[model samples]
Target: MSLPSADADWWRNAVVYQVYPRSFADSDGDGIGDLDGVRAHVDHLARLGVDAVWLSPFYPSALADGGYDIDDHRDVAPELGDLAAFDAMTAALHEHGIRVIVDIVPNHTSDRHRWFRAALAAEPGSDERDRYVFRQGRGADGSEPPTDWESDFGGPAWTRLDDGWWYLHLFAPEQPDLNWDRRDVRDDYLETLAFWADRGVDGFRVDVANLLVKDLTEPLPDRAELATRTDGNHAYEDRDAVHEVYAEWRTLFDSYDPPRMAVAEAWVPAHRRARYASPESLGQAFNFDLLTAPWDAETWRRVIEENLDLAAESGSTSTWVLSNHDVIRHPSRYGITAAAGQPNEIGYIPAFGVDPEITVDTALGATRARAATLLMLALPGSAYLYQGEELGLFEVVEIDADKRQDPTFFRTGGERLGRDGCRVPLPWTSAPPSYGFSPEPAAAPPHLPQPAWFADLSLERETDDPTSSLSLYVAALALRRERAAGEGLTWVPAGPGVVHVVRPGGWHCLTNFGPEPVALPEGEVLLASGPLADGLVPADRTVWFREA
Candidate 1:
């Protein structure tokens, strides 16, 4: 496949910043972030030089599935504000030269969704009922779940509908999987895409995109044989038919004047399945290899090499993410722990089994955290910065049982606490009340004070301080744009744990993940996130050297 012309593929080198709207910043004091809140932060993102902002699901929902179970695709959630606020946000982002990409969940809709409600109320075998997958059991024996496969949140993947049939729920029971086989469903999705496109949304960060279509006849794959489980939800993910769905979406998107990019959240290994996101299909797929790659020189080299090779073979731009709303925060993932007596050994034990008050310290300190940020920003491809990541925020240590909101955490008998730790509110100020998120009354009665860490680390205090993480991120982003590293980069293998990335213009980036100083073949140090004198000390340190 020939590469798209450089002028035509500007998104190939774009950097996307993801915002979990609920936690970003609250403008109306509803104790929740809203569209207006997002508008308030657009300037900050613009100054940071991100190419686009990907807002996680802000659509109307019952809040059962953390906005993934969307009830209305066209309207914003009431808590997030109304259509007018959304328009204002779009305008603000565009004014700052930042594209806006909202999340689109096409696979399933909240059971409360009007479509699902109507489908349930309709007689079986009726056209409305046919919109969703409804199957009768082969007697009492088959009435249970079709397979032993568990939902990503745990328990059976199938839920018994009030109409006496079973419906598949790849994630939560409240989220009934839509029957993509139904022409109505497919048409509805196309219309939804058009609706947003007409609204000026530049693109979409498709959620569970690979699960949009499923093997209607085959039983769910056995979990034991799968290579990996994402959020513990693999029973119905990555069916080959998903490719067809993506191709259809790609065609629809191409019909528009300026082609809209679709970024899929696929967990397939980068090298083995890069073709899934070929130009003919979706524009890009998330690169989990970088997120889960071992913290070592050789591992990093192999992963990047494989990724680049895959990109070359598939002729598709790669997408990289360090953390998102669904997983543990990267700082907690890579930070060293003193309790573990090793670097980058933080354990993300949820508040289920352990004593609610237990605290385990990680050895990774401020320096290591800084290094990780530098490496993430320096990487080539579309970098996804999770909301609050720029502030060097760590994972929330304590989550009360009542405070827990993730369905995955509750479904797994508390085995996997899900993503509640990372989904906590972003701290905009140090003052105690509401953490400056919103003035709205707390969702739960007897509003609780914002966590203490918010005071310890906040954007208000750090944004202007040169030594703060927020300042560092701003500076790095400025450098990234000024040097045009946001453009495609050429990877040159230097040695283990050290690689030279040549970006557009005359810029060069050298990354050393090892514990010892690396000798640059020839360059002058432009920026160093760790002890430059030591070459490259491990546990989160990156050195950028430019050709003199």
Candidate 2:
């Protein structure tokens, strides 16, 4: 079947796959994945039928925050490969009709970046220091942080230097927030966009896109004070000034041949999200409400409706995502419930399953995850698939504490288990140890440990198994490309715990979220996430059909 074309608005309903570079495949046997590794796996992506590949950061980094702390935005990391390797990989993906979207860390730069190093050496208020958000301490002895804002990871956002100066880092201490007010910082980023666009990159995935321009005008509000305010403005996050930066970027992106595209990883409020994807700003913005929603029918329907409505407001298509590098795998996340009848906030759950009040039902989670996939893929807009989720890989909850590397784990003093479990290396073959993740069988272990049960879900084992999650995804994506037509859906009134919606082309999708079978609509079954019983959609299953 022919896939979608790379037209000006190709991303409208595209299925983009995310590759976490370090865990995808290690071509050099260095226990870390590189661009060469990605090049070798192009065929796998082609066979899986993705429209584009959204690559995670592979830029020069100390891996301080798992490559998010980039020292140079223009060059590839020596460990990952050089500019030449990156070009080759990009060419390889395009050869298979897959566009490439690379991550752009415009919000911050690594502390070791040339600009940050210069800022450290230069005296306070110097031009070099102006590239970053550096300020004098506020306390009597200049000992306290300029603001009481807490880092997204943990602790204070400001890291104090020996000179009693402070710099803001919304994430780890190694990643210093850039001063977007500076003309040089903005111009340099524009040049970075041109650099990659010149190198055949199709688009960019803007990291922390909403946090670039902070409102640190004066008297920065503390966390406590901001909590009580009714206004949506903040000292750092989702400020209005950030949209100006993206407007400049939209202009630059429009200059390209096919007109490059971008998706904002903005964690702003639902009302503010569409602003990032406005016609004058970035082309798209991620909607993560579905990722954290519970596996309930009412909640799922509400989130989908809200996302579609918001996207419509901005003249943009909705973006649906189930899992990513930072969060727990959906299969594992679907396994739990709250004892107090409160909704299970999937975002806060730790990797190790350390919360005694919560318990996991593996079988139930897997079933729901498959059902959720059909629901997401059948929706009216774009979708993103995280690596290894095709094989239905569960979170590796038992990694040795010593092997843990997420700074959140350290910053929180192990109270929070962090995201290492979901970042474990992919298993390509049904083998022990490295599991074909490394080119060499005896290559050193993957940076993160893979559970032994991974053998059953390896690509080699699931490639031809029609019942496997990988096979389900392959079939779903193929069918979606051909038959997932229409702009909106009409809700078909159904019994409790059952959701039935019909799309534009007489397409009918029914999902049974309850614990019993439900009557199916009168149509030809095109696909079912799991086996149906007596022509009824089984519990925890989803099915798509159409008029015969």
Candidate 3:
């Protein structure tokens, strides 16, 4: 194996790609993606110029919550691959000059996990049960749930056991919340970190990083009361105690050669997000405010500036994300026109895709999505790209209800369409069967159904088309690697509905969000998201240039 690079701050301006294992590729023709599949596709990432790949949960699980309900923190899922397969995949990615960042679920574990199973069989107040949040009934006859806390997926957070006790689960009932207060729980995670680091894993993407250390004190405060407190003392999300856990993680990360890094998946406000990414804590925290914002100049500008400023307060660079496995793809999100002449908060809304009033202009959405990618890549810090986004894939909103696997789908009784649409398997070739996703074209269907429309958006179709979304990403990423290396970002004055920023390396980026074409600034164009109209940047386009 090669030695680690000397540039320890490689994550600062890096562009990372998120790989949803089950949807990326299937090597064994089992119709499910595996580690061998990922290894086979390292060229795609290397070609796209991503510095690293942040793999979503591939640990042993029942898929109750789409692999987030991890049954074993230190091993890979059998369907995906074993530890040897994981090592081979890591080595392959490293050979292609890409770092590896795997998801670490610290907050919860699957109900089938050894610890959870042991806890279920143990007495109520035993050490086994103490490892998780187990509470008593609230009302007479012990029939009522412990508290009224709601699951993030939907319904109630507490599940009543047959023994008259209840267990807390902030998400699906199959994933029990871990009690971070327990010494064994904390120690086990520390060991988990070492296990991966020893196997050449470069970093970790901590799942639900802020929700780990909950304030599960008695006379449990209601969500309203918890929301009203700014004291950093909360029931579940973003409690101050979470930082202490990250601090411990940071020390562990620093122990590795060249020092491994971590980016937190915390859904807190801009201010608290900085703390999660503080130097003493995890090195970076995802800034997802841009993912939900409408395609408006003012809104995008405000979120960018606020994130940059707040991240600076904690001496950390901001991390920008447009879409992930959990949300609808940006192409579809941007396609929908709001009813009241106002831009809709796409991913943040409840029951996002199932609304009958929602209408998506696919063409317009793809255009805006490309423009957004350029803008995000031009920013001062790191950026994350979801898999298949380079192909400009849209959400497969027409999946049959019976085929959905997301916990949110069943938990909400299909009221919320959930994230299955976005999690559909990616298309590599335009042809039939599994669309080159699996080795056997006649193999069983993918874990989640893929739409027939994917033929047009397959990598094979766009691989050689210079104007295609995949090519745009390849060219933009190449330029970004050279031009965006510096940290400087100076905003240039532009007309209404336009964003212009100058980088330190003579690089200038401008994005036009208005309805009309705008005159290009005096410069030699390096790259453009789409074709320029008569030397003018068209609406919903982004351009990068150097002063002529």
Candidate 4:
């Protein structure tokens, strides 16, 4: 086999595709996606010009939180495949010069996990119970949860046991939070990372990187208390102790022949997240400010400036992301906004809370979505692409309540719709019986039902049409690889709602976010998110020009 790249610095300005494994491809016709499915589909990523693929949580799990509640870190999910499948998939990806980044759930594990199960069966103060966060109830009869800290998925963060003790779960009850302060817990994850690294995996995408180190000296603090402590201290998030864990991880990452790397899903504030990305820490973190910025040139320009600056200060490359497995697709999110300049805080909000008031204009959303892709890809940093955004897929908000499985939906008593919309199996073909995600029509229906309307956005349709969203993504990614790999960006003066960016290789990207068309620059039209007419870029369009 060919040796891994000697440089080992591939993430700098690289395009990494995020594949929700269950929805990517089904090679076994088992109605669920597996590692062989990824091996079969690496060609799509190669053709799309991505440098790597990040698989989201393919480890053994009960699918309690869609595989995020990992039951086994060293083995693949039974429905997915075995360890041999993972090694084969990694080998195939490396064969095509594409790196493999597996997801690591460090904050918690499924209640069914061996450690958690053993913790439950052991005495309250036993060594096994120290692996996770367990506490006695607060009430006289030990009936109340220890804290009022709510789960990000919904409901209380603490699960009460029949034996008068309670377990802490920052997410769903099925996902019990682990106590990182315990030496065994830290050693366990370190060993898990080494296991994947030894198996030839390139890197990892750490889940909830900010929430690892909790302040166990005090009782669980409420959100009100969490907001007041600003002395560079937090109850569980952005704690100084978290960096100690990453320092250990960094040492392990650097020991590889090619020196592996990791990017943290660290969701600290925009201006102050550099510490988590120090060279001794994770070395990279997701800058989500741009993902939530208003669809205006000024707003986007500022977000881009701050993110790149922060990355530079921390000695790390900026990582840009738009959508992932946890939230609504950007095309749908942009379409529901009323106007270009409207400010929206679009995080992971539930559908049941907002569908009654919001209506999405699919055409408008797709137009802006393509323009945004061009803008993000042209920026001077690494970029992340969710699986279906290339096909211009919208959120599937019409799943029947009985079919919904996200822990958030049930935890909130149906007050929230959860993340099922984003997790629906991808449509590979325009036909029925699991689209082409399954190999045959007779296969069991996909684990989560796919919407029939997904046909229009199927890969078959997108692949056939040259002007489809897939074409734009392929063309833009190729251009980004060929032209926009500089370490800095120079902004030229343009009118309001226009961002004029000049990269290192004399390529210019002009985007018009206002209500009217703008005159194109004096250069050859290399690629445009939409068709150029009369040397003018239409409103909500982006065009890249090769300078003479």
Candidate 5:
């Protein structure tokens, strides 16, 4: 009912909702969400019963990669409002007993950032250029990139400027990677961390936490033919030196009275993930297995067990996430494919149903999505939820190709549709136009066009129906808080493709992942993701019960 009854360690088991500022609720009729938008909706989070809110980047930026290309770590974007608006939002969240987890993009900076501008203006090897990951091109006349590492957004990691030198940008060309080896870069972040903590932020979600330090000591190899690897031995990503970066952050953030917490977006292999969340490193490195797991029971069970085990190994609580701003919404994903297969690699990005020429069954996706929610919430550890998921929002894959803005879309030359679908503005009211995302005289057409069908799934419509997705989320969250599952998990062999788990307090959660009906273990049905039929546990359904 309040900030957690527990100590500062609340994040260990918190349900931190992720808010993508561009799409959440827009105030001032800007058609773009702002700090004030979040301020007005703090009660929505509080009523949903989440412990905290993890806000996506709202910093000043060119938005080259949708705000991941941050220009200022210490200042809020003028469009989103100034520092005063951010402070007001944080205060409002605190008033509603919700923790604020601001995103920290230490991996890269927008090309428009002052540091990058100075680097470009100064001569090669100058102090300004040294502050970033800039290097002279290896080829004669400097035509070729320094290395062959591919940018996550697309093309070569190095973007050649007018100068002979090329700067590294693991993502879009507009987002130049920072030189973590530089003392100035490291020291500069300390001030940024303190600036937000002083503003009463409870924690930070470190972006690209594992790729800070690069292995630029040697002649960078051209990875033109190299494929993506998940194993932790990358030249730049998940490097051993990156772990030290988080450790320093831990010490710096701990200086705060309540001691701010941090979660790393490190996309390392299973074996190496614990290092990032160990006692000395960032408090929790995201456990992405669940997000990438197949909808089958065996896979979900394994993901759950492995995540919990790894958290124990590191002496940190596990974190489970279904979807985020960058990925396709779970419901749409569940509908797109009958089976949820493994990811292409460690940091594989889903193309939002664009990869395959198939139509998604939205009804089926919604059913399984509700089941997936129960399975995740019943597990022991924290859960990260993206906004709009609670409203059963599906990916808007049909948005006109011309309306797409993701750098991935342009950089990949339309091969990938990018994340524009899932980032559509939230539908607050059922009407057309802004749908309550913005007020009258809407601003800039919502950044991305909202689908017409959104009116059917608006919060206003859902709240009127008890069986709506929003209603289910509220009820499930209430039960989750009331009967908190303990740190223990025991799996009962409930036949193939059925995972029945019993946590402490005699609570059991059973999910039937197959088409065949599975007999329920003797218990009282406390909650079900879907309607029960003939007292038999239906396939593709999940239910939480108390053992008789």
Candidate 6:
């Protein structure tokens, strides 16, 4: 496959800001975000110094699995505006020098999709029906899922369709898994990519990408066996055939000028992540180790080193994230406590006589968070910034039971509440009534409650405040871009929780995820985050040391 010109190192060292359109901005006063709303925010992203914006799925669907379950690959959902709005958004983003990456879910489609509907209607042997994987004879009894593999969201991976055949759904039943084994399925996705690319769309952030292919030979353990041995569901990620599917996609993407990129949502080990980006596969894959790693120095360092090493070997770019739409915020993960001396962890409230509000003594300070942010931005790869992370926005608090929407909560039997808390709308202004997100008055007819913390911490305010998280992110991006840090670089080990390396310009990057401060003999502090007031001493922070 051909590569883009060396001069276009945009994907490397580029900052990608993820926009969850449903909650980012609402232009039509519909209380839900739309393409027009995203169009209006393009300038804001440019102002934030991000190189591009990765939009979540806005495709037509039943909204059962958020937008991941696509019913139509070509049409935009009516609630999110029409195809015209998408074109306008893309053009507007391009004008701002910011690229647009749309989310593509190839593993599955909504049960309501025409293909699935036709498959359901057709007899078992129909050629049109082969577009999906439908299997019979589960076992001697035929009463359980095909395998003991657990779904990422929970529950059995297979669902019995009305036709009495079992269809696999690694996520939700409504989100029926696509039959990648079929040539038609692959061709359809290629055409979908071409359609968007032809429309000037830059690239794609593929959703649940690693599950495109699965092993059909293994039968799921019986329900009783699964219940006793492990979680009774499907393990659909990181399967062997995923590489082939990705290679196919990469080949198609290469045909386009500038080599439109593809980033996979691969929740796998660092090494597996590397394999997914094996040059011939995806351009890059999101690194979740950082997000999942414990909030300790050694864990962080090891994760970073593993990622760097894997990326280097795979000939792929490194990517990192501290938070995303589907998980808890980073602050909460780090154990937010009042005694730690920081703001209250966004996820937890101060329960009287229980857990009090976190103060500077108990909370993770701005410096620590900033340090992590800087390290993520300065790393030798593309970076993904989740919506509202710039302002150190915390996850939504006090979610009412009725308001909770994540399917995981149901599937996991409430063991995990799902990602609804993180998917709440972005609070642009704290004025009142939907926190400046919805246009309606606070106590008006719609009567939507405003996100209080959003008003307290917003891009508008953070942009003005030098100490604000938003400002810190901007500074970090500026430094990364200035150094041309995206160019040829190698990741070398610097002990656990540390990524040590030299860039093409003879600049050394020493980042420590360890709790204890690390003293670098030489190099200026490009950016510091954590409790270090002077930005010199490292605390619970990440700092880049370039030779002075």
Q: After superposition, how far is residue 364 of candidate 6 from its true place, in Å?
A: 1.4
Give lDDT per model, in order: 0.72, 0.88, 0.88, 0.85, 0.83, 0.71
Off by over 4 Å in 1: 1-8, 138-143, 218-236, 336-366, 439-449, 485-500, 504-506, 518-522, 534-539
lDDT of 2: 0.88
Question: lDDT of candidate 6 vs native?
Answer: 0.71
Instruction: List candidate 2 stretches off by more than 4 Å.
Output: 1-6, 229-232, 337-343, 346-352
**What's the TM for model 2?**
0.97
Provide the clash count, candidate 3.
0
Which candidate model has the greater lDDT, 4 or 6?
4
Better of 1 and 4 by TM-score: 4
Q: Compute each candidate's TM-score over C-alphas.
A: 0.88, 0.97, 0.98, 0.96, 0.95, 0.85
Highest TM-score model number: 3
Number of clashing residue pairs, candidate 1: 15
Which residue pairs does candidate 4 place in steric collision? none
Q: Model 3, stretches more than 4 Å misplaced?
A: 1-3, 341-353
Query: Per-residue lDDT for 1-548 in model 1, tens only?
Result: 11222334656768788898887877766567778889988878887788889999999988787789899998999988998998889888888877878899988999989988998888878887777777765456556665556777779877876656787788898998888887778888889998888777778888877777655555545557444654324445666666777788889888866788778777654443665668878777777775665467677667766776677677876666667787666666665343334333222344422543434334454565566667656666667888888887767746777787888777877777777777788877776666666654645321223577787678788877877778878778888766764436677767666655677665766666666666654677666675555444343567666777
Between 3 and 5, whose TM-score is larger?
A: 3
Q: List the residue pairs that clash in candidate 2.
A: none
Model 5: per-residue Cα lDDT over 297-361, one tens digit each: 88887888888889999999899888888777888777765245433222224454555645578
> Can you tell me which runs of candidate 4 are displaced by over 4 Å?
1-3, 337-354
